[model samples]
Target: MSEGKTGAPHEGPFLLSQLVEWIDREHRNEPGRIIGNLLDALRRSPYYGPLVAAAEKTHRSPTERLRALPLLDRDTFYRHSPPLSNDILTGPMADAYVYASGGTTGQPKFALYSNEEYKIATDVLGFIYSTAGLEAEDVVGNIFLAGNLWTSFNVAGRALENIGCLNMPIGGATSYDMMIKFLQAFNANALVGLPSVIIKLAEEVERSGSNVRIRKILYGGEHLRAPTVEFLRRTLGCELVRSAGYACVDTGPIGYQCTHLGGSLHHVLEGYQFVEIVNPETGAVRNDGEPGEIVSTNLTRLLMPVVRYKTGDLGRWVEMDECACGFSGKTFELLGRCDDLLVIGGINLLPSDVASGLALLPVSQNFQVVARTKNSRDLLVLRLEASRPLSDAQVLEGLEHGSYKLAKAIKDGWLNVEIEWLAPGGLPRSVRTGKIKTVLDERHG
Candidate 1:
């Protein structure tokens, strides 16, 4: 066990004040010491025993030790030859809770968390909600998708409750009329869920001419485009449409958005986890400001030690002081996932770039990027919903200048581009999570 500054074994309740103090505290550890500690703890787990055993031979120097240790990709991290059992757990299984990943990427697997780990995760989540302007007396409507093994709704509920807020667990699967009724009945001052769900609810409110007062919203589960934020702000009468946090079922809380407005960057929770950006193909760590895949080491969870686990998302490590939020910790900006990248004729493009381009145009909040291979060439289709009616010629004219950056790429023959407009409810949606399929790469399929 690690000792605190007073030399006392640092283990206690997960109080918000203490967590905030820890995050704001001025403490630094030697780089080598950090790696040593990580290696020591991970070796205790049966799942990492083989990997760490081979790594012990290269502990002569810190640089050599880190480089010698192989990167734990998802296959090696989550999939075992004989499969993991309770023996892989570092602590007693009875005292820990097991939450599962939704398996959108692959087969669902459980992540074990000790009592202390769960407390710490929820506490950090509460701090994130507080930072996003959730008041003590605010009635928060938790609309994150919830069911068997779903973590979002339960996580947000626990966090909001920890902060002494009245939480209404109106799940995302609820009907629009019922959701509206619950919001009005509880006077939900804060909303939390997927961005697409909230935007859809806002549209429903406008269509039904119902009066609902949602002061601010914290949404995640996907990227919140600037255009969607603007639409939510105007439709729901909310000033803040901030991200809930950069989190997933596999990792409880990656990071949260800073209080800074008009920025998409998330403040890194370095105190909780160690995150590094590395070249996805080479597994070599990247320098600051260089974009790469995010590999995280969970310093908090011991029951299932997730050290140097690849998260598949692409991002860059940025300086904290660059943020206007006055937060003093390293932060990062997520640039879509590694798998979400589209390679066309030796050119790389991200779906987020398409979304950003669409934001510049006077289009609706929702859109999707579809890529298909035809005649040995990549064809890019952009499906957007216009808030108001626009002729095909007018839409083409707007795209040529409204989002000149995207237009230039198309004009330069980087890829063939086509635009299609969808009616109000034309786009397909996942009813379970209330999120639109952002990318449809049919070329691979």
Candidate 2:
């Protein structure tokens, strides 16, 4: 059956819109329908009783019903990351293709994908591109990370196909020669990658004096500062397209924000997945606009049903108000990881704030904000992965300077700090998974 647009909800299970329709189709607004079904599901499903009764007594709204469920951090999810039985087949895991996720060890989240689910993810993605007014003939070069566990290249390529356009998955981590060749050979019209990666590639492309012109640049997987965006826009001679794919190995591609001209992402397909945020400390549900952990409940996938899988990330809704894009749904901006917080003298400091300060100074390409214990107290080590060559002495000196800079940038300066510079290949990649661990809590303090 014909469904809806990219920004609008589609009519199918495992899609958020379909879930909403299912709720409404059951006459959810009849005051008792929601609660009634809650009780029924509780009795029917082995995992439903406690949830249903709790909803009956406590669920104040749909959001609350979702929130009351348990919240899991990265640790808990990893425990059950690889399913051993069919009882957990709630979403696409039943008949889905499994891919490795990001991890340094051989252990990483097993990503699942169903063809039906993937199609919607692609369709919604296409609709988002259409909002940007991309024509069918637009020849776009996807600069996203590709292959095995990193699903961006494949995902974006599929979306472009669904949108009925030309796509070249040039991918990330390629040699400068290969990247230039692919873009030029394809006569690429658009570019995509991390904002920093884009900047690096743009510089290389110009320095190499390659005769190529890209029309649009889409950046994601990390924050893009306004100044950086403006620089790319001026230097690359293309409209900067800021887009993010809400997909992980565990949840697949969820929802994406349309009208990427800088606004909160519309949770386009909530029916395919259930989304919620909660205060990690109290495990209490946070109201809209409050920063909390991002969790997902997969609505599709018969192989595995993910319930309240904690993403260990934090962000907030733009506002309780409606989206200006004319789409009625929740939209949010990713703040950073939930554990990015640091406790000092019982005070908390978010690593993101520190990272932003470091970004201002062009200190490192990536970092590991590690927490360790020495003696009785805790110590914070800033192991920055430097982008350029440096001597051992120079590296030590840079660490000192970085610590001083961090102290100046953040309050409670002079906190325990150890800075190390790892060579380009020193930091291990997620063994088989494509995910990267930005920070490691080694001390458990």
RMSD to the true structure for each prediction, in A, is 4.1, 5.7
Measured with C-alpha atoms, the lDDT of residue 311 in candidate 2 is 68
lDDT values for all models:
0.72, 0.57
- Model 1 misses residue 316 by how many Å? 1.2
Q: Give the runs in model 1 whose Cα sits over 4 Å from its true position.
A: 1-14, 24-38, 60-68, 81-88, 320-326, 345-347, 360-364, 384-395, 412-414, 419-434
TM-score, structure 1 vs. true: 0.86
